[model samples]
Target: MKVLVVEDERDISDSICQYLANEEFLCEAAYDYHSAMEKIHLYEYVCIILDITLPNGSGLDILKQLKDMQKAEGVIIISARNSLDDKIAGLKSGADDYLVKPFHLPELSARVAAIIRRRLFEGKNYITLDKLVLDIFKKTLKLDDIDIPLTRKEYELLLYFISNKNKVVTKESIVEHLWGSEMDLADSYNFIYSHIKNLRKKLIQAGSPDYIKVVYGMGYKFSIH
Candidate 1:
């Protein structure tokens, strides 16, 4: 999944991105308020790590904008000031969670995972789609209790499909979610097609139904109905 880290400090942002990258996320960084605004407007993320004190605006205002836009991305406020007022203010403004600065990176990752699990998988670590079962934390999938081997990209694609089940997810959005802004230079989505084809084949070979369906002139949808 994609995660946006809005922090003014280069070192902090770098560390956060590096850490989360290892945890299987395409991390995008915004150095200030303007960049954060632009990213939120242009892209969708699974979670956003926002700093309370920004270069030109308060993070609370950013949270407000998200609410105004009715974005579903979860927000976690990180602030240097450990004050009850700030926590309440951020929570009131619609932050899903808050963390004081000088926190451990593991704790940060755990919090991010929790928020994403709640947002994407409805707070479950495992997802069961009829005969198929996916363990989010273990990064494993099974069909009728038989292990289904999958490459990293295939697993991610399956997770993305299930996350937006029954909705048309465009090829462009899939590329962005998988590769982030770094894939701007790519010219085609052939790789995406190949991965999806292989994933669908594997699941079906493992005795699961063809859940991924192609939508002509649009993209694809994962549906049981």
Candidate 2:
């Protein structure tokens, strides 16, 4: 899952990013309101860790912007403020949860996972599609009760494809989703082709019907029928 940590405190932001990254989440940081706004407008994330007090503006404004734009990303307010008004306001503004400062990283991670499950996976720990079962928390895939071992990248690719099943996904979008802004420095898209090929081969070997379909020059689509 992709998460955006919108915090002005360098230490807090870094710690959150590090912890979430270790938990197998793709994390990006925005240290101030301006940067946070830029990232919120530019990309899609499964969750947003927002600090209410920012350098240039309040994080509540960011929440309002998200609502205005009708973005579905889950928001979690993590701030030092412990006032009941703040908590109620944040929750009323569409934040999925709130965490007071000096909190445990594990708790934050759990909350993030819960919000992602609720928003993206319909509150389920696993996603079921025909004979395939994807364990979101464990990051494992099984085909007809048989485990299908996959590399980290392969697993992420498969999850991305399955999440957008039957819809054409562009190669650029795939690269951005997996590698984020770093894809801009990539010289070619050969890596995407390689990963997709490997994922397809493994799925087919695991007694699954071919679900990945190349869309000629466009990209690829995952469909069951």
Candidate 3:
């Protein structure tokens, strides 16, 4: 899953990213308020680890903006302050959870997982769609009791598709979700096409129906029908 760490302090931000990376999260960092705002506007993430203070603006303001946009991304506030007022204010401002700094990375990871579970997975580690079952914690997939191996990208793509099932997902959106800032380095979306093709083939080989459908000029849709 993708996560954004919006913290001005580079050392702390890097530490969070490194720890989360081991937990199978693709973490991206934003050093200051402007960059944080830009990233929140441009991309979507499973969860956002936001700092209370920033160089140019307040993270609470960013949280408010996100709520105003009706974005469903989960948010967890991390701050140096541990005052009851601060915690109450952050929760009132739409933060799903709050963490005081100088905390254990395991606790942070646990909190992040809790928020994601509550928001996206309904407190479960697996998601189901017909014959397919995706284990969120294990990062594994099964079709009709048969294990289906997936590359990390393929797994992410499948989860993305399942999360937005029956909706047309533009290739542009897929690229942004899968590659994030790295998309800037790509000359074309051939890699996306390649991944989807491989995923489709694997599912079919595993005796699963082709759930990924191309929508011609539009994009792809994953649906039972």
- Compare the candidates by lDDT and give the number of the best one: 1
Cα lDDT tens digits for candidate 1, 68-166: 999999999998989999899999999999999999999999999899899888899999989789998888999888999998888888999999999
Tell me the tens digit of each residue's lDDT in model 2 across 21-134: 899888999999999989888888889999999999999999999999999899999999999999999999989999999899999999999998887678999988889999
Better of 1 and 2 by TM-score: 1
Q: Rate the local accuracy (lDDT) of all candidates.
A: 0.92, 0.90, 0.90
Distance from true location, Cα of 216 in model 2, Å: 2.1
Q: What's model 2's overall lDDT?
A: 0.90
Lowest summed lDDT window (length 10), candidate 2: 179-188
lDDT of 3 by residue, 1-225 (tens): 789999999999999999998887889999988999898888889899999999999999999999999988899999999999999999999999999988999999989988887887789998887888899878899999889999989998998898788999999888888877767635648888899999999999998899999999999999775
Best model per TM-score: 1
The C-alpha RMSD of each candidate to the native structure, in angstroms, is 1.3, 1.3, 1.5
Model 1 TM-score on a 0 to 1 scale:
0.96
The collision pairs in model 2 are: none
lDDT of 3 at 118: 84
